[model samples]
Target: MERRILFTIMLTSFLTPFAGSALNLALPSLGEAYGASPAALGWVLGSFLLAAIVVLLPFGKLADRYGKRRFFIMGNGIFALTSLLAAFAPNLPLLLAARAAQGIGSAMTFATSMSILTLVIPKERRGWAMGWNVAVVYTGLTLGPVAGGFLNYYYGWPSIFIVLAMIGGTAFLAARRFLQEEWYEDTSPHWDKKGAVLYGGAILLIIYGLSQLNSQPLAPGLLLGGLVLFFLFCRYELRQENPLLPITLLQGNLPFSLSCLAALLNYCGTFAASFLLSLYLQSILGMTSRSAGLILLSQPIIMALLSPLMGKLSDKYAPTKLAALGMAVISAGLAGFALTIHNLALWLMIPMLIITGTGFALFAAPNNNAIMSAVEKKHYGLAASLLSSTRLVGQVLSVALMNLILSLSWDGLSLQETLLQNLQLALLFFALLSGLGVIPAKVRQ
Candidate 1:
């Protein structure tokens, strides 16, 4: 049972985030084949995001009601299927649709991974096990860019999906052969359909509004409409006994809100770095696609190597402090990145990349430990649900905001000049956001 759970968790844990981050490196390739406009490209990026956000909490609840193992196995199969579909897609719209289906699979994988980890690991040892789990999650981010670049270049873009599907399929088969059902049916709670819809609507509106940051400001009506829907969603959640993002999750003595804020700001920096830096290297640095991929490799390389070490540390220390320190270091790294823009050498940038990756690795597991560890055992599902949702909010807005900000200064600039100038300015803001997260981490302390 333990081996079964471990294999499934490790596999799906990486797949969910991998699905999202893989596209970053593949975008240039995808654009060439489909001749996609930025907005159309944005939809390709967003399709998985929107689905993951909408279904994450619901799926978490489903795991609690049914069985985590069940969802893990089934969702892996779904992920495998959708990945194959995505690889074979001939048009942009069809590709986006396939990605959207992939999102459902992603949510299922994430929700189940968290639930299974929480339930399977002992309390005394959970922190360490979860730290390891969290490390694997970050490992996905580290692997995706390198893998995406290589596959797209060698085998074409379709190979990305084909490879991911095979991985997911292997995990599914492993789970089926060895995993056992852990849930004993302790009277499942009432399904909060209305609350679920309300929360989903609110989250979607919020993300949509954020995505528009790359475009013109939201019309007064749309902004007003989103705010109203959000307010109503809050009111509805508080009123319901059974809720998706139960108000109690926030209103209780948990550090939920502050932790979420910290996560958002931290991820904003890294996500911005991931999304923008690739274009910058290719365009401004006058590098080929392969070389650009190599340059961008520094960040994730350090991240993958150091995250497991950071995870072990989280088991002993308060995660908030680690998280804050990590953010501070990342801020410094970004500052270095901005300052050294024109010089841009890989070896020269190694220190900054290492620092940034270390900071993120330090911040990632501990923040997760802080959030999940702080919440009640019974609400593990809710807590895990919220974690995935916050990640959604962070990543979705990060890309959109990148577009919005880059468009401001990059208007009519050559791709090289546009990416260089845009990344410089955006990273400064990204640093500021990360630096500000110290306040929340301090509050948690």
Candidate 2:
């Protein structure tokens, strides 16, 4: 059962990043083929993330109420079908819609994968198992751009989706065959409809409002309204006999809350670097998609290599201390990236990538350990959902911020010096944010 679960999760884990990173490299080609603006291209990624954020928590709670195994299998099916839909999308709107559907599928997997793993793995060996799991994630990311570049260069962008569909299908079949266990945290018959609606609505409002700040005049109003709804949702959850999300996990738990915040900050600091760098490599440095992908591979490669060792170290040492150190290293790496606008050399950038990757490897598994360890056994699904949500939120904010910066100065046609300036400015902000995250890590001490 453990081997089956491991294989199932590892396969699904590999599929998500394999699709995401590859799609990032294919964005330029997609733009040309579909006549998409930079903002529109950003949405191609943003739409998917938005959908994930909306469903992650709600579905996680639902999974606990029903059965995780059933939801996991269903999610894999959704993901596979969406991959096919995305591959055949005839227009930009359809493609974005398909991506959103894919996000829902991904949310199903992301929300429960960790919880299920925690259920099966022994407590003492969890760090090692999580390390290996995270390693597969990085391995997928490591391969994504390289494969994406080659596929786009040879066949076309659509082939990426087709290939992703096949991968998802394989995972789905493997899970269905080998995975026999059905784990449920809450077997009693109950579901939190109001909490689910309020949570999803608030997320959509906030994300949509923030994404529209560059264009819409009333975007701030939308954001404020969303915050109000979110507060109301929390109040409602607290009062419920059996809430969708137990408020205590976040409200009373300092370690869990701080760890979540750190995760959000870390992702916000690092996620958009690749998106911006991909553009810089192809447009500014005149590298082909394949060559740029090879360069970008350096980061995740280091991450994949270091994750297990870091996970082992976390088991022996103070995870918060290791996580804080990792965040500090990330800040330094982002600072290095910011410094490179004036002197854009591949040599300098590669070292910075290595620094950030190593830091991320250190931060990810250990931080996950801290969050999961802090929560109760029953709240594993919630913990996993919240952690994944934090990541998705950070990613959305990173992209939205990127779009806002680009919108302020860019005209969407030609690459200019201002784009690099905006990128540098963004990196500076990320470095500051990552450095700020270290405060929370230390506070957990």
Candidate 3:
């Protein structure tokens, strides 16, 4: 059962990132195929993330109240179905809808998988398991670009979706057959409907607003509206006897809160690395997708190699300190990318990627270990969901920032010096954000 659980969770972790990263590499082809504008292409990615962010926490609570294995199997089935939908999409709107459906399914899986692991895995070995879990994530990311590029180059972008569907179908079958045990800590009939609505609505509005700031006319009004509603949601959650999120977990717990904040900042600073670099390589440097993928391979490959070691280290040392050091290293690497990427020799970029990957490997598993360790057993589902939420939020913000910059600085995929300039500014801002992340990571309970 434990091995089955491990395999299921690891496969779930791999597919989500693989889908996202592979899509990033396939975006240029997608644009040509669908005649999507830059903003529209961004939405192809953003729609999925937004959908996941909206439902993740609420679904987490539901999973705890119901049964995790049930949701996991259902999610995998949905994921596979949605991938087939995406592959067959005849238009942009259809494709976007398919991606959104896939996101909802992904939310189901991520919201419960880690919590399930934390419950079943012994306390002493949890770190190692978490490390392997994160390593699988990097492994998926590591392969996404290379595989996606080759697949796109030879078979077209739809092949990516077809391949994803096959993997999802396999996971679905494995979960249904082998993972028979159901884990549910909360059996209460209570479900906070109002809190869930407000939470989901606020996230949707805020992220959509952020993405539209430079491109749309009413961005400020949308942003303000989302913030107002979010504040209301917080206040409402505070008063609920069984809040959807249990605001107290964030408010009263120092280590957990800070760890979440660190995770958020870390993701905001780092998640867009591949998206930005993929464009830089293909659009700016005029490299082929396959060739660019080879270059982009440096970071996640290193991350995949080092994550298990870091996870084991977190078991023996202070995870917070290790995560802090990783943040510092990330700051330095981002700065390097910002300062020298354009003028530096192409080969020199590999070292920068290695440094950045190392920092992330050191940070991810340890930070996740800290967040899960800080929470109690019953709140494991919530903690896991919140952690994943933080990551999705960070990713949304990262892409939002990228789109905003591109909207203001470039148009129609035309190559211009300003494109590089805007990208550099974005990298520098991310470095600054990462530098700030170090503080939260170092904050002790």
| Whole-model lDDT per candidate | 0.76, 0.88, 0.89
Q: For residues 1-445, could you state the per-residue lDDT of candidate 3 as single tens digits?
A: 7877888889989999898888887898999999988779988888898899999999999998888989989999999999999999999999999999999999999999888888888877777788899999999988887788789989999999999999999999988887878888787768899999999999888988887887689987898899999999999999998899788878899999999999999999988877778778887788986788788888888999899899889888889998999999999999998998778368668888999999999899999989999998899999999999999889878877777766555555445677887888889989999999999987763
TM-score of each: 0.90, 0.93, 0.93
Instruction: Flag regions of model 1 displaced more than 4 Å.
Output: 28-35, 184-189, 213-223, 342-347, 410-422
Candidate 2: segments with Cα more than 4 A from true spot: 28-38, 279-289, 406-417
Query: How many clashes in each candidate?
Result: 1, 0, 0
lDDT of 2 by residue, 242-277 (tens): 788788768799999999999999988888888788
Candidate 1 lDDT score at position 219: 39
1 or 3: which has the higher lDDT?
3
- Candidate 2, residue 78: how far the Cα is off, in Å: 1.1
Candidate number that wins on TM-score, 1 or 2: 2
Clashing pairs in 3: none
Cα misplacement distance, residue 143 of candidate 1 (Å): 3.2
State residue 269's C-alpha deviation in candidate 3, in Å.
0.8
